[model samples]
Target: MILGEFWRGLKSGIVELLSALIAAGLLFALGDSAILATITLSSFSSELKSESVLEVFLIDEITQDGIDSAKTYISSLSGVSNMTVKDPEAAMDEMSAILGSDMTDVLGFNPLPFSLEVRFEPGSCDADYLNRISSGIALRDEVMEVQYASEWLDNLEKLTRTTYIITGILLALVIISSLFIFVSLHRHISTRRRDIVRNLRLLGIPPQSLIVISMMRAIFVGIIAGAAGVGITILLWKLCCNYVVTIPFLTTGFTVLAIAAPVLLALISLLISAGRSQSNLFASGS
Candidate 1:
């Protein structure tokens, strides 16, 4: 009997049902896209940070003993993953290869200073820590200069943080909009079926059963619409990966939540609307 009534309600409001489905699907898709962007940006930023290296230049006149001392000091510092010392001649050679000619020959001197190419561990590449290390290294007698892509790293971190904040706001708005949509859909359907609901109540049908049937209809719509949204998001993600840069899609846990969230929202709306309907579904006839 419950299933019969549920099907009847669905068929009677085909137009409204389709509208709700489309709206809900779009909301879900928007939410999914926000999540994907947050994940991809975070991953990209981490990769860049891990690969970043700090360059420390030595004074031209520093002896080999001073070079060994500097290397020992830097190696003992926390978060120093690895270090490679480039002698003046080696640095000149590298610069010569890049410029297609040796500046040493043109100037009658190899003026490039010795330097250390330093790479840090995963979590210690932030601006503040690197800046502190650079300051300390610069004060050493053998050190000429300390430099790294500090500005670039700072910008990348800011960009990742901004992406996260925007994504969070977008998701919160999506959830709020979804709730409003579900509430409106419930009211619209209930208003249209008022007469049938009143007659059912008069015939000794329990209000709880009526509410349950309505909730069942909501669940049905939620599942179908949620699946549609997931499909759309997947299609978009695939297109992005093919034409644009590649990024991994939603994980299993997030995919499940994307489908379940709409259903949960629908059920919540029905419960709220049912609470306000009193014992009888009609406003005047109750």
Candidate 2:
């Protein structure tokens, strides 16, 4: 009978329930955005220990001798991340794919330079320090056009900032919406007070039964929200993978907690509401 009732109510109330659950799912997505920004900011704020990963692309042309000499020069730099040499031909091939043309034809020659990739400790990503290091290297007679830029960090910072903003907005919406769920449920129960009391008093239904039923309903909502939330998040992750590092939708712990916590909270809130409503009904009948 309870299962039948649940299904009946699900069909009738599907629209409202789904809207609320989807709102919950949106919160899950924003959770990831917040996670990424926090991680990135922490990475930037952390102190330098030994070395950091730095990638430098050379767009200028150079001879094999120059490549070897550049490698030698970079090897001598203090606190090098790792000096890997990318040849101009390799760079040109990559450029062609990105540009969709033979850049060499337009330029009349290979303009790609053999740039040294220098990695330093975490703190070394600073613009002023990087400029000093690169410029200081360029002053060497053999080095040509060593480049470092504050602009290099701009795009990364902007991306994290954007994520932070989106997360904040979505998080607020989710919180407001989650709280709305309790309000809606309470209103529905109050409106159905006659039906609820008639059935309970007629059947001598224990208070525990109502509480358990509400808990079950909450679990159902949570499962749907978790599944829907995870599915949407994965779809987005796939789309972003083409251009950026799209992290996995939810780590195991977060997935479990996201599903569990909201369900528990909803069940508890409804249980309390049920008790208060039932108390009023019993009092009025007396």
Candidate 3:
């Protein structure tokens, strides 16, 4: 198929596959970007459970003065974004609302622990660092059990990792499916090889002309497939991830680049395939 064939299919294949190609393109963008988002989460230790302010288990205790001092120390640490110590009274009130009982009555003499909350900067939440801090505090006899929401952070990390893995598998499926579609279309035209040869022989046309025609068709197909895929990918990402991806640094531009880059590469691949098939036409003519 040449450029003329691409035009021929403008009404036929292009029109038919336009929607599907775009849809596939959108899926390709989402799945690929989803994995990136998840991987980014993993790369940043900010998502740690210790970062979570709420938890169900017993909390470690610290004096107001000691907690304040700890806060200052943690703040100075690299990767520490922010930190706070929620007083026992505040903790009790929050628990009271959730537990549906007067924390005063429920605890009687039991006092809510004066727990410290530390918000780490983007990179501070390493296991070694957290453990070092926890162990250092636990050694102080004045301090109760040192507690922060590490469990929730762990779960978040796992969830992010899982999302990336699933996205990767799905994207592989899309690539395979797209290649199958492209190659299948190539095969359909190739099946009419005898007729193409007979026609060329009768016209006394150069075999190179036929090759040019097929290659020209491939380029048109690539452009159509690429453009449709890119358009659909952007449209879908705008609709779906407008809010979920809240990072200020991230942009729709990356999403568009992600979609367009791959599609263009695929188009180039189609061009190469077309070139390869051209040799066959020349050989048969000889």
- Per-model TM-score, in order, reads 0.82, 0.52, 0.59
Compared to the true structure, candidate 3 yields what TM-score? 0.59
- In each prediction, how many residue pairs overlap at the backbone (N, C-alpha, C within less than 3 A)? 0, 10, 12
The digit string of per-residue lDDT tens for model 1 on 41-63 reads 88778777778888989998889
Off by over 4 Å in 2: 1-12, 32-169, 240-246, 268-279
lDDT of 1: 0.83
What are the lDDT scores of the predictions, listed in order?
Answer: 0.83, 0.61, 0.56
Q: Report the Cα lDDT for candidate 3.
A: 0.56
Candidate 3, residue 214: lDDT: 55
Candidate 1 lDDT for residue 112: 84
Using lDDT as the measure, the top candidate is 1
- Ranking of models by lDDT: 1, 2, 3
Error of 3 at 171 (Å): 0.8
Between candidates 1 and 2, the one scoring higher on TM-score is 1
Please identify which of the two predictions, 2 or 3, would achieve the higher lDDT against the true structure.
Answer: 2
94: Cα error in model 3, Å? 5.8
Give Cα distance to truth, residue 120, candidate 1, Å.
3.4
Best by TM-score: 1
RMSD of each: 3.3, 9.0, 6.3
What TM-score would candidate 1 get against the native? 0.82
